[model samples]
Target chain A: MKPVIEIESISKKFLIPASSQGYQTLRESLTSLDFLRKKREFWALRDISFSMEQGETMGVIGNNGAGKTTLLKILSRITKPTSGKGRINARVASLLEVGTGFHPELTGRENIYLNGVILGLKKREIDRHFDEIVEFAGVKEFLNTPIKHYSTGMWARLAFSVAAHLDPEILLVDEVLSVGDAEFQKKSLVKMNDLSKNGRTVIFVSHNLAAVRQLCSRCMLISQGEITSIGNVNDVITEYTSFRDGDSPGTTDLTLISERKGSGIVRLTRIELRNSDEQVKGTFLMRDDLHIHLWLEAPVKVRNVKIVVDILNSFGETITSMFDSDSGFGLIEVEGSEHISITINDIRFYPGKYNISVSVISQILNHKYESFDEIENAITFDVENQLVNRNLTRRTGLLFLTPDWQIHKD
Target chain B: MAGYEIKPSGWLTFDFRELWHFRELFLFMTWRDIKVKYKQTFLGLAWVVLQPLALMAIFTVIWLKVMKPAELDIPYPLFAYSGLVFWGLFSSGISGAGESMISNANIIKKIYFPRIIIPASAALTALFDFVVTLFLLVLLILYYQIDVSLPRFAGLFSLSIMITMAASFGIGLIVSAATIRYRDFRYVMPFFLQAFFFVSPVVYPLALLSSDSLRIVLSLNPLAGAVTLARAAITGNPANWQAIFPGTLMTVFLLVAGLTLFRRNESSYSDLL
Candidate 1:
């Protein structure tokens, strides 16, 4: 089969200034010779090469800032690669974001035509699919009303409906399916499956591994702007997950992980898992006491801080979350290094691997919460069943809950 | 499936065929601009004519009462109004087109349509406004009882509007491209237009300038020639080809230079934006 999309040694470089200026005016740069000295080159993508045959659904899995969006942009022709080239041999449609070109003041009906044209459809083609789009979005009643008045969900649905109806020979999607409700996400996945089955090529970039595993025939793993592996979906995803988990489970240096976002006032310096005896351990047994130790730092005296920890199953589904506020501990003040511990009496996580994500937020003067730090899947650990000589099969679902039943003689 | 290569090309090359293929997008964008411009406004499309009419009234007072320049063959209101119709086209067209890219950065960053379509749609939207105001111009002409010369009026009117369009589009291309990198253009643009207004002879006639060299230099401004030719068309004055030729050349030069600069930076726009 002929490749529908071919990328040859493509790389993208961006210029970064050493100074922390958000944006400099031309006048300031022209007047100061120091500006020229501060400029530096930052490579966003390095030597990325790949090709996809017709009807292949290729998934791109990576951590944040792994150059996935940059690659998609290059293929979609939104920006050119600084070096190398890409050849696209089909009508291409890219959904970098849904409702990208929507005009707020335009009626839903008018926007359908406008967005359709933007997606490379002719007027008559839009007319033919107009009813289908309106029906799919379930906005037929409000078609004549301006989009500014529509609820956000309705707007996303309309935008997704239009994009889903696009009949391009090649589609480049970037995280747009995560929007709208779960029913719509399911519908979109089904629609994408249909498109692939119909022999249209697709390049899907997403962080949702489950969706990628279900939809993609092949997958590529990118790490720090380079392709680490490319082949079967399961193989690539395994490589990606293993790399993310590191060689030692439940032992991660919070400072070393670059995929974190928040204000710089507070930081999560370190994390540790401890047992009831105050000994640190990576592996725990089912029904054992699970203790999480967090080391935090604040540059200045900060108050009203709340920390949250979420336990996720192997498939990246959240099993449960613990919030500091639930214990009626409204505030914690930190000026420097401080250690906090969270102890769960019963683990109940049934003999499987699970990951933990931590987040820190603070309440401001107006009583609105501002995020201070958030790290997803920061550490992974395994749970084992230690009970012996009992015909006990490892439980099937998320947790092995202990329930007591009392029976009365009838 | 139409195949295309994504290699670096020389700065002067442009894909006019690709732009032509995306003409439907241009039309739709233009339609969107026109629709959104008047959506919530009370007067709606009337604002298109009202803006120039309001400007004409202020300029008439300033030019007639304050400057008190030398008389021409036509009424002062007619002279100022005629000049304003084209001036409005040039100024508003360039402003609209120049800001098109920055305003549509969301679309540009996501999709793969010809980038030129954005500015072109803005120019066309301004053209629609110009057409709307032309009716008011016709009413003013009839009200003032200005004699119309059919053969000369038809040819010169179209040429004048075309000249304005070309000049606006040319400048607009450069401005829109620059705006992506240097957002200071957002603040600089209004001031630049205001300064350009005085130099374009929108209120006073070009003949009011005493020195021959001064008039010739002023005529080099594309709007100067367009406004002069349009005034002549309405007032039945003989066309000044000598004065108009220099401006037409400048218009062509601006258009070529603007397009070359625009095409050179087209691919990088998304990056900067």
Candidate 2:
């Protein structure tokens, strides 16, 4: 079988300016002798090459900033590569983002037609699928109402329905199923599964590993703008997870991370994981006393500051969150540098790695709190159970419980 | 099944076959623009006629009452209103086409279609507005009792509108492509059009310019020729072939230049936008 999509040695280089100025005015560009010298080259993708068969369902898994979106854009023809060549033998439909061409002022019916045409469907094709789209979206009652007036869920449903009805030989989806309600996401996933089952090629890019494992027959892992592995779904996922655990589970530098969001008034300088002996450790036994230390800094004295810590499982889903206010810890006033520690006596996490995310919020006035700093997936640690008798299998779910049983005569 | 090769083509190589395949999208986009324009307004389609009629009223006060020019064979309102109709088409069409790509950056960033369709659809939407306004112009002619022969009126009116549209599309293509890279054009466009309004004979008769050289230079603006030819058709005055010829030639040149520049930059739009 021939490959439906063939990509050769493709590379894209973006001209990023060295200075902070986003764009230059026409006068400055014409008059300045240093105009050409000011720009630096940023290679978003380098010598990337891949090909896919006509009916294969492939999952593209990567960390943030891995150039996954750029690859999809090239395949969709939204942007062309700076070098090399590619070819697509079938009509391509890409859902880079849901509600891409949706206009708030247009009615739901009108927007369906608009989005359909934007997806490369003809007017007659849209008409043939109009009833199916409206019925599937369940917005027939409000078809004539402008989309701005619809509830957020209704709006997402309409957009997803319109995109789901796109009948192309190849579909390129990028994390669009993560939106909408849970039921809708499930329906979309099932629809995609059905499409692939009926001999349509699909390239799905998402952070949801479980969904990827479920829907894709093959998986490809990308790292640092290069494809590291491509093979069976299970093997690639294992390679990816193991690589991630081996790479950075030991330590994380807070200053090097630029993905954080918040005001710069207060900052989380560092985080440390320690045991009862007060020594930093990357692995722990089940039910061990886990101590988490946080270092913070503030330029001025701040009042009513709150700290929040979240524990996320291997799948990046938050298992639990610790808000200082939840446990009757009202607030702490900090002047400059402060060290805080929270210790849990009996940790119940199963034998798997977990990631920690931290955030700090300062209450400025009555009933008003501003996020000062937040770091997501800042650090990761592993948990191990030494007892062989204990059911330490990975399939025992996220929690390790201690139960009491008594024998009674019935 | 058709195979598509993804590579950069030569600057002058435009795929008209690809554009023909996406013609339905062009029509849908134009329809969407027209529907959205009229949907929110209370006056709806009435605003189409009211805009030019109101502009004619202002010009009548300024040129006819305040600064009276040479007496005309036709009523002053007919002359000014006819010119306003074509001028409205040119100005709105060019600006609309210029801003089309930027305003629809959401669609341009997400999907791929013939990039020309965005500006082309904008021109078509403007044409729709022109046709709607022409109905009011015909009523004005009937009200003034101008002897308009149907065959000559149809020919001149269609030719004049087409010329203005061609020029607008040409300018629109160049401006739209340039605006993607240099946003300063967005700010300068209004001022340029405002200055262009005076240079072209939109508000006054072309006869007011006494020197023959002056008329020739001004008539190089396609809108000047289009308005004069349209006015002459309605008023039954002898057409000025000398002034109209230069305008027609300039329109053709602009069309070719606009399409060439637009095609040269179309592939880079997704990156720049």
Which lDDT tens digits does candidate 1 get at residues A1-410?
Answer: 67888889998898866564545567766777655576778777889898889999999987666789989988888888889988999988888988878998999999899998888888999899999999999999999999999998899999988988899899899987778789878988999999999998999998778889899999998876889999999888766655254536556778877656577478898888877887777789888888888888898998888888888765555688888878765556888888888898878887766778898888655757788888776777778888544433435466777789899999
Listed per candidate, the RMSD to the true structure in angstroms reads 3.1, 4.2
Q: What is the interface RMSD of each candidate, in Å?
A: 1.5, 1.7
**Best DockQ among the predictions, by candidate number:** 1
TM-score for model 1? 0.92
The C-alpha local distance difference test score for the whole of candidate 2 amounts to 0.84
Give one digit per residue, the lDDT tens place, for model 2 in A335-374.
7888888888888888887778898887546857798788
Candidate 1 Cα outliers beyond 4 Å, as residue runs = A243-248, A259-269, A291-311, A320-345, A357-375, A387-395, A408-410, B8-12, B211-213
Kindly list the per-residue Cα lDDT of model 2 for residues B155-272, writing each as its tens digit: 9878898899999999999999989887899999999999999998988888898899888799999999999899878977788878898999999999999999998888778878
